[model samples]
Target: MTQQNPGSAPDEESPAGDPWHAFGYLVAGVAMYGFLGWLADRWLGTSFLVVLGILLGAGLGLYMTFARFNRPPDPQSKQEKN
Candidate 1:
């Protein structure tokens, strides 16, 4: 027989889990894209490259944001037994 703990479940709602991780990921991605754009502009001496970088970065960031919302609640922190 297995003993279950309160609020412990394989699937639980945690507001502090995925949102923070997803935000961090989004920030890092944006920063990376910005850096790449700066590098491209510095090396190529063209602003178009930077613009492209921004567009790509924004697209990727939005994708990640949407993906995070689609994911299920955290399983590790779920409290099973009440």
Candidate 2:
């Protein structure tokens, strides 16, 4: 008697749902790390920390984005639905 939408499940949240979320994560990480690196550079009189920070931030941001968004749907949810 219940009608469910085809191809899209109620509990399923596709990663493509909100791209800005990922973008924000990446940008925030880069900015924070870059700022820290700049501070270290100023304190140590080194110019490479900024670049290192940026790279580290980008890597971490990407990792977090994937980790947070790329989760497999819960098997229990599907079982319960059926």
Q: Which candidate has the highest lDDT of all?
A: 2
For model 1 the TM-score comes to 0.58
Q: Write the per-residue lDDT of candidate 1 for residues 1-82, one digit (tens) a residue.
A: 7765666464454463467777776777777887899898999898877677777787798787777777775565444422
In candidate 1, the residue pairs with backbone N, CA or C atoms under 3 Å apart (3 or more residues apart, or in different chains) clash, namely: 5-81, 6-81, 6-82, 7-79, 7-80, 8-79, 8-80, 9-79, 9-80
Query: Mind giving the per-residue lDDT tens digits that candidate 2 earns over 12-67?
Result: 65554377878998999999999999999999999999999999999999998898
User: What are the models' TM-scores?
Assistant: 0.58, 0.77
Worst 10 residues of 2 by lDDT: 9-18
TM-score of 2: 0.77
Q: All predictions: root-mean-square deviation over Cα?
A: 4.7, 4.1
Q: Local error of candidate 1 at 63, Å?
A: 0.6
lDDT of 1 at 79: 41
**Counted clashes in each candidate structure:** 9, 0
